[model samples]
Target chain A: MLELQGIAVSPGVAIGKVLILDREGYRITRSQIDSADRHNELDRLRTAIAEASKRLEQHRRDSTEKIGVDIGAIFSAHQQLLLDTTLHREWERLISDSCYSAEFAVSTVLSRYAHAFRNMGSDVMAERAGDIRDVERTLLEALGGAPLQVSGGLGQSILLSHDLTPAETAGLDRSKIIGFCTEAGGPGGHTAIVARGMELPAVVGLGSFLHRIARETTVILDGFSGRVVLQPDEAALKDYRQRMEVRAGRVKQLTEIRDLPAVTQDGTRVTLLANIEFPGEIAASLQRGAEGIGLYRTEFLYLGADTEPSEEEQTTAYREVLSQVDGLSVIMRTLDLGADKVGKFTLLEPESNPSLGLRSIRLSLRQPRMLRTQLRAMVRAACGGKLKIMFPMISTLHELRTARMLLRQVIDELAEEGHQPPQKIQVGMMVEVPAAVLMLERFVREVDFISIGTNDLIQYTMAADRSNEYVADLYAGHDPAVLRLLQTSVDVAQAAGVEISVCGEMSSNPITSLLLVGLGVRILSASPASLPQMKQALRQVRLEDCTQIAKRVFDFDTAREVDAYLKTRFAELLPEMALGV
Target chain B: MGIHMRPADLLSRTAGRFECQVLIENNGQSIDCKSIMSILTLGARQGTQLNLRVTGPDAQQALDALCELFEQGFDESDSEVATEQTS
Candidate 1:
C-alpha cells in the first residue's frame, strides 16, 4: 500500500478504481504546406473554428444550468475567443505567408497570444493566458488531435489529474466520478470551489505522485484527513471500509440530534450560531439547528460587482436576511474590505502591508460616507427584527465610539426622513486585535456585546500569515498566548455583563468548541456544516470537565503541548465523537 | 478585475454587423475592435481612456454605438439593477 497526504479542500471518503487524466501538452510539428493548398488550409481552419464554437456554446449552456451564470460565463468568454475574426485572420495570414500547415498555423498564432498574456504581469490578466490555451486545445482537438473524452467509459472511479480548470471541473460526469485528487491546486482556487460546490471528496496540492499509480488501481481517498492510499492491502482496505461505515453512522447519529439543544451534560446551555455570508444560507443554517447567525459578513455586497451597492439595494438585502432569520439576532458587520479582498468597489491606495494597514473598521472609518450608507440601510432594515451591528477589527475605544456615533447619526437621519427606527438596537465589535484584548475592560463598557475573531487575533498575536505556508506553523489558535488573550476578553466581557462569543475558524472544530466553552464563552459560532457535530461534542461533555481541560491547557507554554493535551482529554471525555476528530 | 464586463458582453455582437474597420488603442497599443481577446489584452481598467478609431461606410454608426457602450461601463451597471429587479 502507498499512502500520500495532501490538503483537504472538501470532506468525504471514497474507495474506487483510479482513472488517470493526463493533460499532457499537445505536440505541434511545423510541417510545410504547398502554396497551391492555401485555400484548402483556410477552409480547414474555418471548419475547426466553427466546430469548436459550437461545442463551447453547448458547454456554456450546460454549465449555466448546472453551476450559476458566473461560472457559465467562462465558457461564453471561450466562445468569444473562438469566434474572433482577427484570430482567424491571423491564422490565415500565418498559413499563407509562411506556407505552414493548418495545425502549425493555429498553434503558432494562439500560442503567441497566450505567451503575451502570460507575460502581462498582472495576475488577473495572466489567468487569461489559461483561457487562450483552452481555446487552442479545443481548436486542435477539432483539427483531429487527441480529444478529451469526458464521458461514456468510467464507472465509480476517482479522477487523478495534473490539474483541472474550473470549466473542466464543472463538466465532470457526476454519476460515474466518485471523487478527485490533483497534483496541483490550492484550497482557494476556482476549481476547489467547484469541487466543494459539487460536494465531492477532493485532495489537492499533492505535488507529483501520478506517475507511480496505474489505471484501475484500487485507492482510498479520505478527504477529512487528506490521505490517498493506492492499492491498499487487505487489512488496510478493511480498515477503510470500516471507517466509511462509521462515517455513515455518524451522519445518521447527527441527524437524530439536529433538534436538540447544544447544552453540556451539567445543564450549561451554549448558544450555537452560524457564520454566514449570504441571505440564502439562513435556511440551511436553520436546518443544521443554528440558534441564530452570530457573524453576518456583509463584504459580499461590495466584492464582485462593478459599483457600490446603493442604500436602497443594501436595504433590500439586509431586510431579506433579517426576515429570513425569523426574529433571531442578525449582526450585520460593516464592509470589511481591504487586504486580499480589496476589490474594485472600495477605493483605497495600495498599501505595502494591508493586514496592519487600512483594513476593516479602519477602512470604514476612513470612508465614513460608505459606512453611513450601510448603517442607514441597516437602520432602515431594523423594522422589528432582532438586528444588531458589529464592527470588525476594533482596536481602540475611540474607533468604537466613532462607529457608534455614526450609527446614532444614521438612526437620527432615518427618524427625520419619517422612518420608524428601532428604539433599542444592540451594538457590538469584534475583539480581534491584541490591543483590544489588552484593553477589553474599557472597550466592553462601551459595547453591548463582543466576539473574538480568533483567525485574525491569532494572526496578529503570532505576527504570522496563515496563508503563507512558511509561517503557517507559527499561526496557531491553541498557543498559550492566544488562550490567555481569549481568557482576558471573556473575563472582561463577563465582568461588564456583555455577551461574549467566538466567531472564527477556531470555533468550527468540535475539539476547539469544547475548549471555548471551558474558557467561559457562552456563545459559539462556526460554519453551518460544523454545527451538528459540535452539538454532539458539546452534549457529551460536562462544563466542569471542560473548565478543567482549559485550566490545564493554560499552563502549557507551546501550542504543540496544548494540542497534545487536548487530543488526549477529548478522546477520554468524548469517546462517542472521537473517531472523526 | 478590470473592465468588469465579461468578454462576451464587452465584445458585443453588433460590432460584427458593421462594415467599418474599427481599432481600439490604449497605451500606444492598438488592436482589432471586433475581437474579445484584443479587448481583454488591452487591460483597460476602470476610468481608463481608450481611443476608438473607425473608418468605412458604417463608421459613424459603429463609433456612436461603441462610444455609448464604453460610456455606460460596458453594460456592467445593468447587472446590479438586474439583481435588484429579481429580488
Candidate 2:
C-alpha cells in the first residue's frame, strides 16, 4: 500500500477508483491490453478511425454550407489526415505488436506525428500539430474515451490530476466525481473553493503522485487527515470506512442544528446564506437552512454551452431560483467570467494578464449587449420581487455607473416593449478590487448593498494569485491590510446603511466566519455545505467575544501572527468547534 | 517574402487523380504525395527545391501534371504578396 500526505482542503472520507487526468484535465488511460485482446483492440482502432472520419465528413459539409469552402477544406484535411494510411498502420503496429490498448496506441501515434510536425523547422508545419490534436481528440471521443470537458460521461471515481483550474472545478460533474486529489494546488486555491462548495473530499499539493498510480486504482482519500492510501490493505479500508461513517454521523449532528437560528449568544442575529452555481442547488441550500441565496454566480449558464444563453433562458433560470426561495432575497451576480473561467462566451482578445485584463465588469462593459442581455433577463426575472442584482469585479466607480446605466436602459427598453418592469430591484457591486475598497464610501452611496468577495480581494490586494500555489502563502485573508480593508468596507456600508455581506471562501471557514461577524459583518454567505457549521459556530459565541477577537487580530503584524492568535482564541473560547474546524 | 502554395490543398486536389506512386523528395526526406499529411510534413517553404519521383502506368502523365502544377504554384494568385505572416 502506498501512502501520500497533502493539505486537506475539504472534509470527509472517500474510497473509490481514481480516474487519472492530465494537466489539461483529459482522461489518460494508458494501461497495456492483454495479448489475446490485440485483435479486438486493432478492430477497435479501425472502428474509431472510421467513426472519426465520418464525423469529420459531416463537419466538412456543415461548415461548407454555413461558412465557406475555405473553412470546409480544413475539416476535409482533418478527415484525410484521419484516414492517413501510414498513421493507421503505425497505430495497428503499436496495438498488435506492443499489446497496447487502443486508446494508448492512438494517443501515442498522434502525439508522435504532432511532435514530428512541431520539429519540422517550418511555422506552417508546426501549425499542423494543432490539426493533429483535433483529430486525436475526435478519435479518442469515437473510441469511447471520456469527452474532453471532464464534466460529462465520467463514471464514479476519485479524480487525480496535476491541478484543476477554477473553470474545470466549477464544471465538475458532482454525481460522478467522488473527490479530488491534485498533485499541485494549495489549500487556498480556487479548486479548494469549488471542492468545498460541492462538499467533495479533496486533498491537494500531493507533489508528483500521478506517476505512481495507474488509472482506476482503488484508493482511500481521507480529506480530514489529508492522506491518500493507494491499493489499501483490507484493514486500512475498514478503518477508512469506519471513519467515513463517523464523519457522516458528525455531519448528521451538524444538520440537526440546521433549523436553529444563526444567532449569537448575546441575541445578535446574523443572516447566513448560501453561494450556489445552479438554480437546482437552491433546494439543497434551503434544506441546509440557508436564509437566502447570497450569491448566484450566473457564469455556469454560459460556460458549458456553445453559445451564450438567451435572455429568456437566463430569465427562466433566475426566476426559478427566486421563486424557490419564497420571498427571500436572491442576490444574483452577473457573469463573472475570465481569470481562469474564460470560455467560448467572451469574444475579447486573449490578454497577456487575464486577471488584470478585460474580465468581469471590464468585459461586461466592453460588450454592452452581452451585459444588456443579462441585465434584461435579471430585470424581467425580478417581476417586482426580492431579486437583487450585483456586479462582480468592479474596480472603479465608472464601471459600476456604466453597468447601472445599462441596466436602467434595459429596464426602460423592456417597459417600452410593454413588459411590466419590476417595481424595485436592489443593485449592488462586489468589493473585490482594492481600489473599490479605498473608495468604499463613494461606492456604498451609489448601491443598495455590497458583498465582500474576499477571494479576488485578497488575490488583488496581495498581488498573489489564489490559484497559484507558489504565492498561496501571500494570498492570506488574515493579512493586516486585508483585515483592515474588510473592516473598512463593513464600516462604510454600515454608516451608509447599505446591507453588507461577505460571500467569499474566507467566510466559509469557521474562525473566519466568526471574525467577519466580529468585524460588524451581519450577513455571511458561504457554500450551503458550510452553513450548518457556520451556524453552529455563530450560535456558540457571544457577539461581544467575537468583536473582541476581531479587534485583537488587527494588532498582529504578519498573517502568521494573526492566524496563531485566531487559532489560540478559537480553541480557548470554543473548544468543541476547534476540533471540527 | 516568397511564393506560397497551400500544400495540403495542392496535394488533395491532384494526388488522388493518378494511379502512379507519387513521391516528393525534399531535404533528404521522401514523402508520399498521395497522403496530405505526408505532403504537409515536407515543410516545403518558398524558394525550396523538390524532386518528384513517379512510377506506374500513368507515371509520365502524373509527373507532367504535378510539375506543371508546381510551376504554376497550384494556380495560386497573389501568394508572394500574401507573404505568410509569421508570428
Q: What is the TM-score of each candidate against the true structure?
A: 0.65, 0.79
Cα lDDT computed for each candidate against the true fold: 0.79, 0.82
- lDDT at A4, model 1: 97
Look at candidate 2 and give me any clashing residue pairs: none
Write candidate 2's Cα lDDT for A1-581 as tens digits: 89999888888788887777654245765435678888888988888989988999999899999999888878877887888777888888877887767776777677777888777656766777788888888888898777545446556888888778766777777788898898888876656876877788999988877656643468899887799998799999998888778768878998899889999999999999999887878888998999999999888788767788998899898889888998898999998888677767567675779889888888888888888999999999999569999999998889989999999899899999999879788999999999999999998889999999998999989999765666778988999989999999988899999999999988888899999999999899999988988988899999998999898997889999999999999898889878766
lDDT of 1 by residue, A1-581 (tens): 89999877667899998766545344232234678888898898889989999999999899999998887888887888888877888888877887766776776677678778777777776777788888888988887665335345546888887677655665567787789988876554445544654657898878777655632478899888889998889998999899889888887888789899999988999999988766867887898899999998887667655799999999999999989997899878888878766656666876889889999999999999999999999999988788989999999899999999999988998899999868698999998899999988898878889988898899899988654435657878899999999988888888889999899767877888889999999899877777898999999889998899879997898999999998998889887677675
> Could you tell me the lDDT of residue A103 within candidate 2?
71
Q: How does model 1 fare in lDDT?
A: 0.79
DockQ of 1: 0.27
Q: Write the per-residue lDDT of candidate 2 for residues B1-87, one digit (tens) a residue.
A: 112225465664576688878777776788887877677665565556667777788877777776666557653522221111111
Top DockQ prediction, candidate number: 1
Clashes of each: 0, 0
Residue A346's lDDT in candidate 2? 65
